[model samples]
Every structure is written in C-alpha cells, then in structure tokens.
Target: MTDHGHNHKHASHKTLTKADAEKALNLVLDSVISAIKSHHNINITGFGSFEIHHRKAREGRNPKTGAKMKIDAYNQPTFRAGRKMKEACN
Candidate 1:
C-alpha cells in the first residue's frame, strides 16, 4: 500500500518496465531459494526471515479409504514476518 522507492534507486520510477520488474523479482526470489538450498537462513531487516523447518515422519490417515499411511519426513521452507511488516499490515 506504500511506495517505499526501494526499487527505484537505479532507475527512475517512470522508467521501470515490466521486464525490469520481473527481473528484479526473479533475482530476489532466486537468491532466497539459493540460500535455502544451501541450508542458510535469510534475514531481511524490516521485512522477514526465511528458514527451513524439519518435519518428522508420522502416521497419517487416508481420507477416502480410512487407511493408515506413513508420511515421510521433509524439510519445509517457512517465513516469519518482521515486526515492521506486521505493524504495517495492521
């Protein structure tokens, strides 16, 4: 809801094209994914943090058949919003 002007540092706001915006977004997303793949946590001040959460294997039930199933353990990517972001949302 606010224009932070953080993305206009290199180019004028009016000069930003669709491709530029996509590229910038892709770069940020790629960086975050790469960090997570490397088992590293990313902390973006005033925004949030990205980390991996481990899920233990557990027994689950099949909805249709009412049968028991074994769920495999996995690592899940999680996000926790920073205080500033939460405040802004409210």
Candidate 2:
C-alpha cells in the first residue's frame, strides 16, 4: 500500500485477473444500485448508510434563453459515513 495523493491509500490485495475483478465489481455495484433504487435506506453496519433524499422542484432560468423553467422533483441517493468507517480515513 502507498499514498498516491490527497490521502488516497492504495493497497495491493489478493492478486486477481482484471476480468475477474471487473466481474466481481460489477456484481457488487449492481446489487447496490438495485437496493438503492428499491429501498428507502440501506445500512451496511460498520460502513455507512445509503438513503434516498427527496429534492423539490424549483424554477430556474435557462442560460441560453434566460427563460424560466419548471424543474421536476426527484429522489437522490446520498451516503453518510458511520463512525467506524469515518475513523478508517484518519
């Protein structure tokens, strides 16, 4: 493990082929994406919580035409780190 920059730690774990690692990553991310899409909140114990936040619609002006537009409200997922996970960075 070595420090690249901005306190980003890089560690060499079990050596795996690129294809194998990509497949595993995609599988894990897919599960997370699916869970976030369907559930309101997901708590990963020592990691953190991924919860959806609702954003209300607002009127905004277009840069090109300066025309007022109505924006549609939507839900966005946000992550909040837990104590154990937050301590790991330090």
Candidate 3:
C-alpha cells in the first residue's frame, strides 16, 4: 500500500461523527480493494486512480545474510493522483 504519511487522527477532524466517518471510509476502501483484486482500474476523477502493476520474477538480496534470492513475480496495486489532487496539495 502507498504510504502518504498521514494518520487516522489527522482525518478525524471531518464533520461526521467518528463512527460514521470510519464506516464511510471503510466502504470506499473496500470498493477500491475489490476493484484492484479483480484486476480492474478504478478512477475517481479529480481525486486519483488505482490500478495494478505487474513485476516480473527477478533476483533479490537478503539483507540479513547478504545472500542472493529469487523473487517471484507479482501484481502490485498502485495509485496516481489526479491533476486537481496534486494542485490541492501544493
């Protein structure tokens, strides 16, 4: 998952009550996760987009023992902010 460096407390200032806010947030998150799981791209205009990224199997290193290892290919979820979202942050 992408780490934007924000925490739950930071989002708790919304007008809705904590429970309602959490429920709404969870619903949205569940929908996004479901879409990604189905290999579908989700786009929320003016907010962002979510899609899957594929990585081929490759060699990797084990940091603890400095040993080489084979990393299996995988599909990773990725997000990209929309134009309006970027402008809002700046």
Q: Estimate each model's TM-score.
A: 0.79, 0.64, 0.75
Put down candidate 3 lDDT per residue, 1-90, tens digits, no spaces.
Answer: 222222244346656665665666678899999999999999999999999999999999999999999999999999999999999999
Candidate 3 weakest lDDT stretch, 10 residues: 1-10
The best-first sequence of candidates by TM-score reads 1, 3, 2
RMSD, every candidate, angstroms: 4.7, 5.1, 4.3
Better of 1 and 3 by lDDT: 1
lDDT of each residue in 29-87, candidate 1, tens digit only:
89999999998999999999999999999999999999999999999999999999999
Q: After superposition, how far is residue 10 of candidate 1 from its true place, in Å?
A: 13
Off by over 4 Å in 3: 1-16
Q: What is the lDDT of candidate 2?
A: 0.74
- In terms of lDDT, the poorest run of 10 residues in model 2 is 2-11
**Number of the top-ranking candidate, with lDDT as the measure:** 1
Q: lDDT at 88 for candidate 1?
A: 100
Output the TM-score of candidate 3.
0.75
Using TM-score as the yardstick, the better of models 1 and 3 is 1
lDDT, candidate 3, residue 18? 56
